[model samples]
Target chain A: MTLAVLDGGTYYHQEAIYGERLGGRFDRTIYAPELTAADLAGCDALMVADRIHPGVLRGKRPILLDYLVGGGTLIVLGENSAQQWAPGVSWEFRPTNFWWWLEQGGDPGHRIVAPDHELFRHVGMKELVWHYHGLLTPPPGATSLVDITPDGDPQGKGGSILYDHCHVGGGAGRMIVTTLDPFYHHGSFFMPAASRFLGKLLDWTDEAFRTPG
Target chain B: MIDAILLDCEQSETGAQALITDLALGPRIDLVPFYDLERTVLSRTRALLLGLHSDQRYLASRRGQLEAFLGGGGTIVVCGHIGHPFLAELSPFQPIHGYRVDDLVVNREADHPVWAGVDPADLSKRRGVAGFYGRGSNPPPPGARIINSLGPSRCPVDFDCRPAVGGRLLVHAGADLWGYFGSGNSSERIMPQLFDWIAKPSEAA
Candidate 1:
């Protein structure tokens, strides 16, 4: 199987680390800036970061919708800093300046693990140690997954949202909006478990691979 | 027991949706739209999911009711961009905003119950959302033990603050939890952990 990761400047450490660890999972992993409708014509799956907004995505890249609607899988990571083209959502993302908060004693050290999630099954409890800025908005029609909690409280307001996977035209797409820094941060890429988790996600995307019994 | 999960409505549902699905929280998470907020924050509600907005008017209007709810031992989770503002008003600590320093770090509390079985060193190395647009003041509501803190400056990251009013407030500045779930890594593990945290057993009450 081959996969294309949408690359526009936004880089994720997890993606790279996963690629390195699970390089053999897919035949090829292509990183490109916006997969135009035509660009996706022959691709098996597309991994997108927070590059394509709702406006630019509308009809322009029918291939994406078509791919998902047709049983192909699409995974979206990161948040649009400007919230320009994201359809069915509204909110602005604040860049992490790391100045004032650092002086006030703000450090990013926390291991977020969803013990019951399927993606973590093979790896089982991966730890990430980097802080990435996130988006602020409720993604309509998307099912939320994972949340940042302080002292055992999950109701906290500022965290990421993973949305529902739906069939659009002829493919399937999953949208995830997060504040956790995946690529830019360094420590996140160093963990072996983290790499395994990424590999699992890539493998799951393939319809041929069934979860081991 | 509270009947519904009350969420402050302002920013769209991006953040909360993650908790709802990933963590399996809020079968009844209610969105209290800023425009529709009345004097009382619905007496029947059990918890409040607060989202920060640019408009202070909306916050001020609901402050009293929220205070009352907290005093009554209500559960509240504060998130979104205006995390600093909400913490300042609800807790003793005042949140300081703006950019500061580099090399963001998160130190873990060895003795904290939340850190039980979790390694402090491994936890410490984990970097939180950098370039926080918000900040908080005062020590985490008095007895609130600091779970995660800034590197040298000692700013709190993940902590539990208990108001004198008897309510529990959990504060987290990071906003990447939802994305981790959507990444489709360990859905089996992630979902259960999320639901377990969000919907603690009744004994927790």
Candidate 2:
């Protein structure tokens, strides 16, 4: 199946790197900076970074919501861009800006588990690290794969790391909002755990696309 | 009835407590412990104070809930580091790259409500003492206005703002304010003004 990635000039390097890594897994990966509904004609799945959003993709052109409704797998990243671009998805962007403090030295010290989940087939309950920009608040309809816990608190709702396949109409997509900068070239090197997690996500997305609705 | 305060649980809390406590803005502040945020933040609270550090996980989970709470007219105070991936999703502000604390030098906007009691000179003194790391790339949602700024970078170190989602929002990026709050000396000087701006009377029209 073909994977079409929406390009918006932001985080191009990360997408390119992801393309390279997922090369063998994907039959063909196309980068479309100015994506229209027509561009998604033969694509099996679409991956968008911080650039493209629902409003920008609306109108006569092939819209994101339409694509998902039409049975395509869509993955959107970047905390702020996702919030602005995809409104109907039902996730919120918390305004507690703290990227610098974590990079300097802020550790939540917790382990995340999606044990029986499809995404964690290769990566099980691992010691999750905090090194990315910020996370996404999961929509009510979506299922959470990873939850955040700080200092032995029983509730795991602080920092939600992973969200599972959320269905919108006839389409199905998985939204992974993370603070980990997996899109950055250095992200893979800086946080090896994130790189591994991303590989698993791409794999899961591919599987989700191939599964019957 | 602003009964409880909601502080963003992250490294900045250490910094925020320093600043808020020093200012003596006592409002029975509750630091949403990192582990139990959902329980603490989702209570029957009227007002919330968020001190965001540079932790991605904290921003991701809290941004949306805070928006919903604020949209329903909750009071929120955001301080320390700014700009997260989820910010664009929740508000109109876009995260632009490359604005840091060292870039600011003076306050350009003088007449904003968040700055009601403070002098322009005192705010200016905060320029060197306080520094912000992130610069918001997008314009503040239509009605929001700037109260304090670092002239050269055009980065807002302080703001008397409102979100497009319709909540009372206060944003401050000055690192020194955090340092001062944590130090606990000049709190009487700074905390009251902040509380006045954040803690609006429940009956005010």
Interface root-mean-square deviation, each candidate? 12.3, 12.3
How many steric overlaps does candidate 1 have? Answer: 85
The C-alpha TM-scores of every prediction are: 0.39, 0.41
- RMSD (Cα, Å) for all candidates, in order, is 17.8, 13.8
DockQ of each: 0.02, 0.02
| Residue-by-residue lDDT tens digits, candidate 2, A69-153 | 6766666654334544453444433333334233424544334555676766655544244343345566766666666554322
Once model 1 is optimally superposed onto the true structure by TM-score, how far is the C-alpha of residue A66 displaced, in angstroms?
A: 42
Which lDDT values do the candidates have, in the order given?
0.43, 0.48
In model 1 chain A, the worst 10-residue window by lDDT is A182-191
Model 2 regions lying over 4 Å from their true place: A10-15, A18-32, A50-62, A87-114, A124-128, A150-159, A169-180, A185-189, A205-213, B1-205
Docking class of 1: incorrect
lDDT of model 1, residue A196: 45
User: What ranges in model 1 sit over 4 Å off?
Assistant: A1-213, B1-13, B21-23, B26-28, B39-41, B54-57, B80-103, B110-139, B174-205
Q: lDDT score, residue A92, model 1?
A: 40
Best by TM-score: 2
lDDT of 2 at B154: 68
The weakest ten consecutive residues by lDDT in model 2 chain A span A183-192
